[model samples]
Target chain A: MNWVWLHKWGSPKWFYALSGRYLPWLTITSVVLLTVGIVWGLFFAPPDYQQGNSFRIIYIHVPAAILAQSIYVMLAVAGAVGLIWKIKLADIALRQAAPIGVWMTVIALMTGSIWGKPTWGAYWVWDARLTSMLILLFLYLGVIALGQAITNRDNSARACAVLSLVGVVNIPIIKYSVEWWNTLHQSASFSFTQKPAMPTQMWFPLLLTVIGFYCYFGAMLFMRMRLEVLQRENGSQWSTTEIDRLIGEHK
Target chain B: MLFRQPSELVNPLAFFTLVGSLFPLALGTQPDFLRASAPGLLWVSALLAVLLSLEGLFRSDFDDGSLEQWIVSPNSLAILSLAKVSANWICTGLSLVVLAPVLALMLGLPGYCLPALMLSLLLGTPILSLIGAIGAALTVGLRRGGVLLALLILPLYVPVLILGCGAVEASLQGLPITAHILWLACLTVLAITLTPFAIGASLSISVTE
Candidate 1:
C-alpha cells in the first residue's frame, strides 16, 4: 500500500545512487550467468536430433529475441509512466532503452538469419516471427530517430514516448498481420515455434540464458539511465555536486 | 483555403502515377508481370504518396503559429486535429484512390480487379493519412523530418499495405476478398478513432516547444 517509492523513483538523485549501488551486482551476475549458460549450452547440452549442433545458435538467438520483445514492452511501460506521472527519470529510461532494444533486435535478426542459412536453406524468409522482429527493429529505430531529430529536449522525449506508445499498440497488429500474410503466401520457410519436446537438456540452458539476458538488460538500462541523468541534469544541484565528487576522485 | 487549391492534389497523384509507371520499366515491360505486380505496386505507391504529402500536414501550421492556436483554443485539439487529418485524407489519400484506375491501367492491372483495387484504396488510404499524420506531427518541427517521418510511419503502414494489396490479389485469384477488406476497414476505423489523440499530443509538444 506504500506508494512513496513511486514518487521516490521520480527523484533523479535517488535513482542515480540506488542504481549505482545496483550496477556492480547486476554486472557480475549477468556476466557470470551468461558465461555459464553459454558455455553449458554450447558444450553440455545435447545436440538436436533434427538440427544437429547448428541448433545451438538458439542459445544466443532465442535470448536476444526474448530481450527484444521485453525491451519494447519496457519502453511502452516507461513511456506511459513518463507521460502520466511526468517522471523525468522515466523519460530518461525510455530514451536510453531505444538503442539497446534496437541492438537486441538486430542481434536477434542477425543470429536468426545466420541460423536460417544452415537450417532453412535461405538467408532470409518472410516468416511471421522473423518478419515481426524486423518490424520491431524498425519501431526501435523510429523512436531513436524521432528523439535525435527534435531539437527541444523535453519535446523530443514526449514525442518519442507518443510514437513508442503507438508502436506498442500496433506491434501486435503488425505481428498478426505478418503472420496472416506469411500463411497466405505459404512462405517456404519453416516456423521455428513448432519446436519439438526437448528432454530438458536444451531448454534448461535456455532458461538460464534468458535470466542472464534479463539481468544484462537491467544492468545496461541503469548504466545508460545513469549517464543520461548526468548529461541531462548537468547544471542541476545534484549533478554538479556529483561532478565535483567525480573530479575530486580523479586526483 | 487549401480546399480551393488544385495543385495540392496534382503533385501526389502525379507522383503516384510516376511510381506506378516506374515499376514496369524496372521489373519488365511484359504486361503479365505488370498485371501480376499491380496490386502490390499500386498499394506501395499510394503509401509513398501519402508519406510524401504528410511532410506538409503540420509543417505549414507549425511554422505559421496556427498549430499553437489549435492547442490553446477552446475547442478540443483532438477534434481539430482530426479535421486536419480528414482534409489530408481527401488531398493525399483520396487523390490516390481516384487515380487508382489510371495507375492500374499503366500497370496492366486487369479490369476485373479494378473494383477490388479501388475499393481497397477507398478503405485503406484514409488509414494511411490518419496514421501518417502521427509521424508528420511528431517530426514537424525538425529540419530533416521527412526521412525520419518515413522511418517512423512506414512500419506502421505495413499492415495497411499488406491488407490492401492482399484484397486485390485475392480478387485476382478469384478468392473472396471480404476478409482483407474487413481488416482494412478495421484499421481505418482504429486509425480514425485513435491517431488524432496521438497527433494532438505530438502537435502540442512541437508547437509548445
Candidate 2:
C-alpha cells in the first residue's frame, strides 16, 4: 500500500481539515475513557492492598507522567520535522505542544507528590525519579521561555526545537533513576506489554486512563493548532475567507 | 565531514584537561573520613574532567565563523558532529579512562575494585562526551554561558553518575555488577546513536542567531 498521505502531512490546510474531522471524536473518547478510568480506579479496582485509599492517585499520576514524557517526544519530533521540512504547521505543532507538556509535567509532579505523602511518608524527597521529573519540568519551561524570547518566528521554533531535542537526554535518566540510585520510589512494577503486577481491575483502568490522556492531549493540541493557523494565516487572502467563515460560524 | 577537518594546529582542549584535573589534586585534605569517600571523590573529579574538556568543543569554532561554515557546508552535519565528538571522546574521554586507575588509587579506591572502576569509566565516559555534545552545541555561541551550560546538562548527567558509581560500589561489595554494566552500555549505545543528530541540529540553530 502506498502511504503517500503521510508525506503530504506538512500542509497546514490539510492538517487543519483532517484534525477538525477528528477533534470531536477524540473529545468524546477522552471524556468517556477518563470517566471510566476514575470511576474504576476509585470504586471498582481494589485498593493497593498496602497503601489504601491514597493509592487511587495512580489513576491520575501515571497517566500524567506518561503524557508528560510522550508529549515531549512528540514535540521534539514536530520540532525536527519543522527544522527539516521548514513546515510552518510543524512549527505550530511544536509551539502548541510546549504548554501542554509543561502542564502535564506539573500535574505529574503534583500527583506524584500527593501519592508520595501516603506511600513514602513524605511529600518530597531528593529521589532520582522525582528530581529528574522536576528537571524535565524546567526543561519544558526553558523551551517555552526560549520560544517566547525570540521575536523571529523561525528562530523561535528552531531554538525551542533544539532545546527540546537536547532535553531528550533526560528521558533515560528518568527511566533508570530508581535502578541507579537507592531511592524511595520503587521500580516500575507494570509494563504495557507485560502482565501488570496489579490485577486487571486496577490495570485495565490505568490502561483506559492512558488512552484517555492521549486523546485529551490530541484535542488540546488540535485546538491550539487551529488557533495558531488562524493567527499565522490571517494576512493571507485565502485564510482571511477561511478564518472569517470560521468566526462567522462561531457567531 | 571532510569539510570540518581543520588545517590549523590549534587544540585548546588539551591544555584545558591538563590544568583541570590538577585543581582537586592540589586541595589539601586531612587524613579524615572525607578522604575515605573514594567513590564520591572520583565522581566529583570525573565530573570536573568532563566539564573542563567540554569548554572548547564548540566555543572555539563558534568564535571564528568556522561553526557557521560547518553548518552550511555540503557535508552531512550529523557525520561531521559525530567525528568531532569521537575526537573529543578520544582525547578527553580516553584521558579519563586512562586516568581512572591512578585517580581511583589516590582516592583510596580498593585494589579489588579498580577493575570495576575502569570498566565503568570505559563504558560511561563516551556517553558523557556524547551527552556533553548537546550542551556544548546549545551554548556554543553564547557569551559566558558556561554556568548555563552546566545547569542545563548536570541534572541530565545524574543517571550516568549514579550508574557509574553504582557499578563500582557493587563491585566493591562483591555483588553482581553485570546489570549496571549492561545499563551503562545501553545508555552509551543510545547516546552514541542519537546525540550526533541532536548536536548537529542544535549547533545549526545556535549559530543561526
Tens digit per residue, CA lDDT, model 2, A1-251: 88778865667777777788999999999999999999999998987777888988889988988889888889889877887778888889989998999899999999998888878888998887787788788777767766765566787788777777667756666556654475667766556888788888889999999999999999999999988987887787767888889789999
Best by DockQ: 1
Question: What digit string (tens of lDDT, one per residue) describes model 1 on residues A52-78?
Answer: 999898889888888899899989998
Model 2 TM: 0.75
lDDT of 2 by residue, B1-209 (tens): 31255422123233334443454466554434433456656765677667766766887778888888887899978888999888777766776777777766655567898888888888988888888788778766666667666766675777788888888888877899999899899889988888888888878877887
What TM-score against the true chain A does chain A of each candidate get?
0.92, 0.94
* Overall lDDT per candidate, in order of appearance: 0.87, 0.78
TM-score of 1: 0.95
Q: Which residue runs does candidate 2 get wrong by more than 4 Å?
A: A1-9, A39-48, A83-86, A125-152, A155-174, A177-208, A242-251, B1-36, B71-119, B174-194
In candidate 1, which residue pairs get closer than 3 Å at backbone N, Cα or C atoms, i.e. clash?
A: none
Cα lDDT of candidate 1 equals 0.87
